[model samples]
Target: MVAVRRGDVVVANLDPTIGVEIKKTRPVIVVSNDSINQLSQLVVVVPLTKNIAHLSPSHALIPKGVARLTFASKAVTEQIKAVDKRRLVKRLGILPPALLTQVERALKNTLAFP
Candidate 1:
């Protein structure tokens, strides 16, 4: 199985999406626990978008150069989902600890954790 871990940015084929869902192939952040990634064929992910109009409590601002990306990105914590390992195309790079923490914080707010 592909080795995915929390905070890793991966290129995934998110096609076959339903209406209003993030579509096409894109970068996504792996959010599942390491143990979960190791033991299951699925991993949880949060999609990143270049269409960042503004930052919100539910979005983590990712600077350009992050994960070798040419453009700055934003993590849409609200769009988190799980997909089969087969959907992961490649690992772009892993988010640094500080940025990863920021994403996690936004994710926490999205999940309504205190």
Candidate 2:
């Protein structure tokens, strides 16, 4: 039996003494949108922390730090779109050149942003 059911949000608890860390359980949701499909698929959001180890190869890495963002989900794209719309409205009164440059850089590095 699973202690946590659907729609439950969890967090990670790091324990160095035991060399064990508690991690958040990804949430799964079943969407029934006719536009998508008739069958419901499980959408999971796996939260991850920024890997400081990847920043440098020689440095001693610690996994004690939690992720800056609270949750990671398929909803990220929508969230990003919403944020961008707000940014466009609030800053520059148009799509800022700096924002576009950052987005281009992100695409060059990861091929995806959001």
Candidate 3:
């Protein structure tokens, strides 16, 4: 599990199976390259958002359109306020069959509805 101290800025992995967990941690006031070093094993570190871009230069820079759905899906899932499965589907744009199945399974096991 990725451990983050309180007040650390972090992002969540987009995969539902990976769940809402700290994906990166930026140093206070300044984004450090090391903020993303620990994420190498867990994610591709695509620079899909402004916060992402500030973290590191080595991260893969995904085009905005391609990453929009991914970022939204991850954000919606992390909210997990109620069982709003539609939000997940909508944010994904076009969910892959395998990814859909994995999300369903994770929801069943975690009962994460939001």
Q: What is the C-alpha lDDT of each candidate?
A: 0.92, 0.23, 0.28
Cα lDDT tens digits for candidate 2, 6-70: 22222322122223332222221211123322222322222223343343211222122112223
Pairs in steric clash, model 1: none
lDDT of 1: 0.92
> For candidate 3, lDDT tens digit of each residue in 21-110?
333321111011344434432221211233443322122222234313333222112223211112111121223345434434443444
The lDDT of model 2 is: 0.23
Best by TM-score: 1
Q: Give the lDDT of residue 52 in candidate 1.
A: 79
Candidate 2: segments with Cα more than 4 A from true spot: 1-23, 26-41, 44-46, 55-114
List where candidate 1 sits over 4 angstroms from the true fold.
none
lDDT of 1 by residue, 50-102 (tens): 98788899999999899987789999999999999999999999999999999
Better of 1 and 2 by lDDT: 1
* Arranged by lDDT, best first: 1, 3, 2
| Cα error of candidate 1 at position 1, Å | 5.1
Backbone N/Cα/C clashes per model: 0, 0, 3
Instruction: Give per-residue lDDT, candidate 1, residue 32.
Output: 93
